[model samples]
Target: MTPHATYPATQFRIARPTHQLDAVVAFYTEGLGLPLLYRFEAHAGYRGAMIGLPGVGHHLEFTEHDDGAPCPAPSKDNLLVLYFPGRQELDVISRRLEDHGVRPVAPENPYWEKKGLTFEDPDGWRVVLFEGSFGGGGRST
Candidate 1:
């Protein structure tokens, strides 16, 4: 069966504002292991980055003011759940995050059933590193 492409987005971007852009970038790139797909400085007094693994069809982007002004507080309920292919990969990711001084947190919602480790970003937004998922195909962005 063919899936109808109603949305024009082949690439989906989730954007947020950060008070600590460097730390946030480090968390995604160094800690979470997402590749730094690109970085840009906008004339609108903010710069940002796009991060994701290759060929994922979707990525995360964030912007921050050069003045380091605080944005609105991040919601604890918002989450970015990333799925790795295997348990070993999850282990590796866990270690990387730990090396970056991140401690795992129990998710606000417990439906994950301990299948993954959850870490909060510098902005207090949550990201779940789970073991196994349908990796990036056959869906609209």
Candidate 2:
């Protein structure tokens, strides 16, 4: 769908503040294997990184203010769910995450426990690597 036809925006960004900027960037970039699209330092006393697949119309922005950015995750249930085509695709990424010292955790929701692997990032935010299309006729939980 066109940007104007959707939410009146051309792109989408999920922005969050964290004290562990370096670790957070590494988790998404190195562990998850997402490309770092952009990075900035000392911009109005904030340093940040944007990471996601290029040309995907959406990306994640993580920022840290010079003063202090101790934004802890509010809940274990809040997650960033990434749906892969199948287990093979998800396993490939899972291996990389494991190689980087990331491990899957039991999801707070039992539905996810049956659907995919859930991992907590450095900032205590959860990420679920689901092995199916999100809105397609993949599998029921």
Candidate 3:
């Protein structure tokens, strides 16, 4: 008998601080093209928004900080790696981000054939857009 498989990695969320929730929502929705799934403003001044692809469990949640507590700035040591379905889409999204005033950093062309582009978000977090699997035919951008 074959063994049963269970539980695949489905979703993730990140927290960030911002005084401009509306602008941040616009960036994720209009600029990145992620659909707004939900927004909440609790009584204690807690606020958040969830953005994601339609029909997929994948999502990103941006939470606003209360008590005037400052959220730490993003560092180079921490990065969010995003994988697109293909290289073509990666290029398209990269261009879109640039058009929205978010310039992508230098792409990483690993010898293993994976290519990726990095960029910083409004809160200074590093987001890396990557495509392709490790080891195989490599193409130049």
Candidate 4:
């Protein structure tokens, strides 16, 4: 089968359920320096936040069910990789995460160890801050 030359997804979000909504939001906003774009509370027994770089086409959504969100990270290798263009950004984010009491964890793969630093969120999901840009600058062409 062949792929479509151009698919049509105007915006994107990676959503996850978390029990610790506050810590999760802090991880993305304070630790990673992403802005909180939108948030809601007690809507259908849920509370959540969307965080990312403003004007970017994608963001992360973390939600909690009032009943209890027992979702856990599937594995250490499951990661949301963010590509950065320089080491300065990496250093700044690293310091911020450290100040927030979030320390980098060793990655499961050696390739990531060589190219980036990894950290786990409050719910154990891993996120990577790569030291260089991804193909086509991490944006869809």
Candidate 5:
């Protein structure tokens, strides 16, 4: 199997410091419908949140320092691509996002619109929700 087709890490952690902890957490939990796996309550004056779907091998973590800046402005080019099983699942997620006041947006990349809808999170990060991979187990393209 190709390297991208294979599962390399047992557990993957992507840590990024965010100034908007509450807004960012709400975006993931409400807009994306991700579960809050766990939390660190200002661990050593650093607050953070980890979010991901169940049975996934990795999680997206957001952090902020208590003594750091009060507000965080996410980069424009920061993009996260997520794949859903089918249109049915995508529609359900869309409804969830709408309920949370997140509407579909046109991405800078035209391919995303052709594949699926996109949304800009509270922190200004982009989220592309597209169709799932043919071979499904854990990680996907």
Candidate 6:
């Protein structure tokens, strides 16, 4: 057999401008259930926080951009998609988000062979919770 190779994404980070860092933190930590990994004062009168997820080799870093620099508008350009191991986990996550008053943009269901839910962060960053393989007989174009 030939030698095998593996590639995995380590982490994801984004700089978000917000007038309410505390509220953002609460939304990400308490609302989304991601653990606050780190927080620090950034340059030019700003702050940031890194949130970690269990089992996934990825973490989300939120940075506060310079004040009065025109808070970046939300878009569908880039999104942060998270995958769970199964449907039960997906349901639990969706319920938690709802309990925290975060309405999911797209509720959970089996689509493209996976059960999942979709929503946007306070800063308009797209977040998703999916479970299943997007391969084999069922795939989306």
lDDT of each: 0.83, 0.89, 0.70, 0.86, 0.81, 0.68
The most accurate candidate by lDDT is: 2
TM-score of every model versus the real structure: 0.84, 0.90, 0.72, 0.89, 0.82, 0.70
Q: What would the per-residue lDDT of candidate 6 be over residues 31-79, giving only the tens digit for each residue?
A: 7788998898966776888787776656766667656446576665355
Sort by TM-score, best first: what order?
A: 2, 4, 1, 5, 3, 6
Kindly list the per-residue Cα lDDT of model 1 for residues 79-119, writing each as its tens digit: 88888778799989899999999999888877654578889
Clashing pairs in 5: none
* Model 6, runs deviating above 4 Å: 1-12, 55-57, 107-114, 133-141
Candidate 4 to truth, TM: 0.89
Better of 2 and 6 by TM-score: 2
Better of 2 and 4 by TM-score: 2
- Model 4, residue 54: displacement in angstroms? 2.0
TM-score of candidate 2 versus the correct structure, residues matched by position = 0.90
- Pick by lDDT: 5 or 6, better one: 5
What is the lDDT ranking, best to worst? 2, 4, 1, 5, 3, 6
Steric collisions counted per model: 0, 0, 0, 0, 0, 0
For model 5, residues 11-55, the per-residue Cα lDDT tens digits are: 888777777788889989977899998788858899898998799
Stretches of candidate 1 off by over 4 Å are 1-6, 67-70, 134-141
Global lDDT of model 1: 0.83
> What is the per-residue lDDT of model 3 for residues 30-93, given as tens digits with 9 covering 90 to 100?
7667799999987377788988878986778777756654767655546666667798998888
Against the true structure, candidate 3 has what lDDT? 0.70
In candidate 1, the residue pairs with backbone N, CA or C atoms under 3 Å apart (3 or more residues apart, or in different chains) clash, namely: none
lDDT for 77 (candidate 5): 54
Candidate 4 Cα outliers beyond 4 Å, as residue runs: 1-5, 136-141
